[model samples]
Target: MKVAIVGAGLTGSLLACFLARRGLTVTLYERRPDPRVAQVERGRSINLAISERGLNALRKIGLVDEVMADALPMKGRMIHPVTGALDFQAYSASGDRAINSISRGALNNALLTAAVAADGVSVEFEHRLVELDSAVGRMVFATPAGKVSVEADVVLGADGAGSAVREQLLAEGIVAENVDFLDYGYKELSIPAVDGEFALDPGALHIWPRGTSMMIALPNPDKSFTCTLFWPAGSFDALTSASGIEDHFRINYPDLLPLAPNLVDDYLNNPVGVLGTVHTLPWQAHGRTALLGDAAHAIVPFYGQGANCAFEDVVELDRCLDDTGGSWARALPLFEARRRENTEAIAEMALANFVEMRDKVASPVFRLQKQIEHTLERLLPGTYVSRYELVSFSTTPYAEVQHRVHRQHQLLGAAAVAAAGVLFAVTRSRARR
Candidate 1:
């Protein structure tokens, strides 16, 4: 089969590699210049947290070890409060499983290299997809050299949240999409290495949780940390002056102020990126074209599952093809049916985690609850698993994780009520005596 994949990004490049392994002739068309040669645009790059799901996909393609060589494993979240000492919350009950932090650009470049080296795969850079006819599997691209047209047996849209291929599908009225943009925006900043070493502990994902806004720092392979500030969309505009920026950090993120020497410059110059969730009615059209990754469903990054979920989509799609004996007609619908619910569940969880990270992570009650959850997980072993553990450390389907977590919470709530009632009865009996 001849496959054309739009967007040579992380998902698209990785997908190309997967299809190539299946003996399919695949061509990747990317609008942007090759990431291996171009400098990354500032302020927009968010580091990815690669967990089991992402690694599982890479393992299948024999790229897991290569990718993890540059990744740093973060075992837990290090909560930096406004005052007092720092608190740590391990992601897994056993405290051994961790999510790997890897640069988005680096991972993309690695995948692109693999895709290029894979047999039966070719990549065309600077090919901006301008037209796509899913019904006939024909695509037109505007290149710097000139307009180029190609025909393929199958086309996949992994172009990301603002996918041009998806736009063409919308224009043709083949699919419906709904984008729910959060009022918040994020700006990326840097905390360079100090004395040739990391500025903070590289063992955890550092979070500065203010009530309404939050900042998170993930360690990079270069011994630096990529810090992102999530705030109200309009709030970034309020800090225009150097003093204003410094003062805001002093009051909200004091520890970060001294660590980031270029704070003022990064704050003022960096662009604030909008956060949103994209929901598409159907990810496939005419059984000849399909959407995957962020194009199909774009979720916020709070749960750190955006990239992981996209990787899982590639795995599931490959499995569908295996089941259908490489028939696109049977595989496309099966892929969508299998992924839609899981993606929806993760989208909802990611949004809810935003509130938990920015507001609840610093609360005493929230800490106590996490302790209890961890305790239960240890006591019950396989019977009890925290939502964070189920999502990050395991390959459990996202929809099933959501269902299991709900049931566990219900049981815990009932147990608590029963214990409270018994205590009240004992107190009443003592009073009567």
Candidate 2:
């Protein structure tokens, strides 16, 4: 079968590797020049937290060791409060499990290299998808040389949140696309290594949660930290000058001012990226072309599962193909059916996590609740699992995990009410006696 994958991104390149390994002829069409030859883009997150879900996918293709060799393990969130107090929250009750922090460019390069080395895989850079006819499995690409048309047995749109293939599908009335943009945006900044050593703890994801806005820093292999500032839409515009930028940080993030020397420059130069969720219905068109990853469902970065989720899509698609005996017609629909519910669950969780990361994590009550949850997890073993644990440490289906967490919360609430009633009755009896 001839497979055409649009985007040549992390998901697309990885999908190409999977298909090629199955003896299918795969060609990856990328709008951008090959990352192998071009400069890396600046706007996207420099580092991503890869959990067990993403690791399992890489393991399937035997690339886990290579990709994770240089990744930094983040065991938990290191909350840095404004009052000069630091609090640590372990992700797992056992305290040993961790998520890996890896460079986005490096990981994409690894997958691209793996796909290219496969027996039947090729990549065509500068071939941007302009049109697609899923009914005929035909595609048109706008290339640097000229417009090119091709026929395929299967076409996968791994393009991204702003996918051209998806646009074509919407134009054909095969699916519906809905994008919800957040009033908040994000900008990337750097905390370079100070004198050949990390400026902060390398084993934790550092967070500065300031109620309405937040800043997070993940360690890089080079010993520096990639800090992302999530702020209100007009917040960046308010900091117009170098003095204004300095004053803003000094007031809101006093400690970060000295740590990030280039903060002012980054604030002045870097673009503020929009945050949002993308929802699409009927991800497959005519059971021959389909969307995956961010193209199908793009959520905010609060949960750090965007890339992980995308990688899982590739793995699930491969499984569906195996189940259908390599028939694209059966596999595409199966892939969409099995994936939509899970993607929706993750999207909701990701949006909820933004609030937790930005405000709740710094609250005393929330911290105490986390401690209790950790204690329960340790005491009950398999019976109690935190939402973070289920999302990051296990390969449990996302929708199942969300449901389980909701049920757990309800059970805990009922138990608390029962305990309160018992205490009240005992107090009344003691007073009467």
Candidate 3:
């Protein structure tokens, strides 16, 4: 049986590698020229944080070590307050667990190489998927010579947020998709290494919290850090002029202005990235075509789980294929039926985390709550673990993880009330004496 996978990005390439290993003939199509040979896009970050979910996918095809060779480990979040000293909050209770920072372009190229090396896999660069006919199991690609058609027994769309195959599948009455955009957008900035050394804390994910808006920096292997500025869309345009940009930074992020000499230039020139939540329904198309990765569900990057979660789709798809004995007709729908709830659960959690990261993380009461939550995670290892831990470190299903975290929070509230009562009773007896 021949399977046609669309979009040779991370998911598509990895899926190709797994399918080919099972002796299935797979043809991977990508619109852009070979990224390895072409100029890499400057907008998106060159690297991403590959946690457990992503690493599990890469481990399936023995490419985990190759990807990790250049990755940097980030142990925790480094909170930089407007006033006072910076604080380090370890992600794992033991402080040993970490998420790896890897170059996105490099990883994609690596997967493509691995897929091409497989016996039954063939990759075609510059084969833009122009049209997909789900009913007939056929695809039409706009190639250099002109339009080319290929017949397939099954097709999978690993295309990203803007997916052509998904649009076609919806037309065929297989899927429904909705997108909600966050009013706040993001823009990229850079802090180059100083004298070939990291300018900031290399062991943590640094953040500059400015109340309503915030800036975060993630370290790269090259000793540089990529800073992402999250602000209201309309607020950013007001700083178009040089003086306006300078004045805005001076007031909002006074600390960053001096450290980044060309802050204004980078802010004005860098593209404003649109943040949105893509809620897609019924990710399978009657066994002929199915959507994986971002094509099925795309969440905002506030949780830093976007890429990692996409990598997870690859691993899950491989499992589905194996369990169904290579019969995609049964595997695709079962995959969607099982993975859908978890994907949507994380999508909602990711949105909630935006509020936690940007506003709540700085709140005193919220910080106390986090402390209590961390304590519970430490006290009850098997019974209770933070949602972040399950998503980033363990293989627990996202929906189950979220459910348990909520229950644990209730217990924490009761504990706080009892402790307060004990303190009040002790104080009253001392006053009577």
Best by lDDT: 1
Tens digit per residue, CA lDDT, model 3, 115-175? 9999999988899898888877789999898999988988899888888888988777777
What TM-score against the true fold does each predicted structure earn?
0.98, 0.98, 0.94
Stronger candidate by lDDT (2 vs 3): 2
Better of 2 and 3 by TM-score: 2
Question: How do the residues 295-319 of candidate 1 rate in per-residue lDDT, one tens digit apiece?
Answer: 9999999999999999999999999
Q: List the RMSD of every prediction in angstroms.
A: 1.1, 1.0, 2.0
What lDDT score belongs to each candidate, Candidate 1 first? 0.94, 0.93, 0.84
Backbone-clash count (model 2): 0
Ten contiguous residues minimizing lDDT sum, candidate 2:
36-45
Q: Which ten residues in a row have the lowest lDDT in candidate 1?
A: 39-48
lDDT-based ranking, best first?
1, 2, 3
**After superposing candidate 3, which stretches have Cα over 4 Å from the reference?**
418-433
